[model samples]
Target: MHQLEADALTSPRAPSFIVTLYGDIVAPRGGVLWIGTLIECCAAHGLSEGLVRTAVSRLVSSGRLEGERIGRKSYYRLTDMAEEEFEAAARVLYAPPPQPTGWLVTLSEAETVSTDWLPIGPKAFIAPRRNDVLRPNAAVLSCDTVAGIGALRDFAAQAWPLAEVGAKYDAFLSVFEPILAHVWEAGAPPGPEALALRLQLVHAYRHAALVDPRLPEAALPEGWPGGRARALFVRGYLALTHAADQHIGLTFHDSRGRLATATAATELREDRLRRECLA
Candidate 1:
């Protein structure tokens, strides 16, 4: 078996893998899935029924999921709080490559900084500009590059864990590159395998991409693997969607009936990813 397939079968925890399922599949199909369906899906990743139940219960308690029962069968969907969080994550995972905005530099008297802000030095942090970020007790300044792209790259390497993030991208490429090659040479795997592969692809890429500071290309090291990884993710995901959707249509269920195989929202998401890959 391929290393990527082995990793998919062995590496995921019940809770995070279930989150991946909801984010990638269940959410787009109306955000609810029957417990039996959830268990069958999780079993592909070697998660036991009991483990899935415990994880679902924990997710409900933690405000990430809510459960309902119809007579004897149970179903779960994301909570409002979890939906908001998932939406944020989906933007990172599905949106096109971010354009290079100038930096937001913060000067604070506090010793520590929010995880969103990268520590450049003592009492100072920097991040990509976003309107929503709170810079409490800090003088925030928007910076435009006057000169020295090299200097900015060096500073970014130090401030953000670029090397570590690069390693993650490298690992992602190692796993998915082979799968993409196989898909191109042959075809997508069978429906069940396709669904499992698609979920694993999202889970692995999300792990690497979310932690990325997403610095401007000029500010990043030469030949960064992030762009390559993003392209592969888009291509591989789009390639598998047909078979995976077939699996979902046949196997996924909720209280009302079988979940949608594709919705308008899911189609838009595919279009966006296709545009990104082409661009």
Candidate 2:
């Protein structure tokens, strides 16, 4: 004759908020936050319910989270592997760059702009359109339209298909580091001109690689790159340039006469990153 046990279950919010909060908790490699507790915690951070749910579903599917059912309640926590991986990612995200001083804000207000077309060197516009003459420097010379295509070709030639892609990332970053260093050294207006061109190319390649969908579109031109890897590469490439336009005031003038607005979020991030605007 034991009395019936009272049930303990937390009310559910929008699936999206749940997922995103779960990710925030797990992403820092911290302790498991009870689903009930997490809702309150994340609400303060302004995460939406939809984003939380989406994040949770993604983590579960990706094997980053585990749930334990207890009567009417379920408790979820990050797995050890997820903890390790997420912590590593977090370290990279917050890692301090060599130059902590901000120097990007001194450009004239007129110099700051964002647009759809890629900004190019007058040389790129005037240089003979001979694609054959472009030599591979693996760093400073890599451009979005051509250098990116060559990266794919180099990747294809690798014994392990992804090896050259990894190499390309290393090479590109190596080039980017020096450009950033110079900016930290000389400030914005007088920084080496080569620094801007190199930054543009790197930015272009990064965005071109990452801006596209994670899934390949069937309609891509003949000899299309496929699979998640290629899609992610395209996304990175596009996102880089998008960041520039939104933050650094870059305008892209493509074959078509059109302009795309820079994202306000990008501008905010730049405010934090650039020396001139830091609060």
Compose the digit string of candidate 2's lDDT tens values, residues 1-279. 001100111122434334333332233323354454444343433445555656666767878777666665555677888677544432222221232111111111223322211224422211111222222222223222323545534533442223334444444444444544443455432222222232333332333233321111211223433232333322332334343333222222212211233334334333433432222
**TM-score for model 1?**
0.87
lDDT of 1 at 120: 66
TM-scores of all predicted structures: 0.87, 0.27
For candidate 1, write residues 1-279 as lDDT tens digits.
345467534558899999999999987778889999999999878899999999999999999999999999999988889888888888888874465577788887555456668766787878776554556566888987779999988988887889999999998998789777877787888898888889989998998998887876778899899989988999999999999998899889988999888998788888899888877
Error of 2 at 233 (Å): 27
Worst 10 residues of 1 by lDDT: 1-10
User: Which candidate should be chosen as best, given TM-score against the real structure?
Assistant: 1
Q: What are the per-model C-alpha RMSD values against the true structure?
A: 3.1, 22.6
Judge candidate 1 at residue 123 and give its lDDT. 74
Question: Candidate 2, which ten residues in sequence have the lowest lDDT sum?
Answer: 1-10
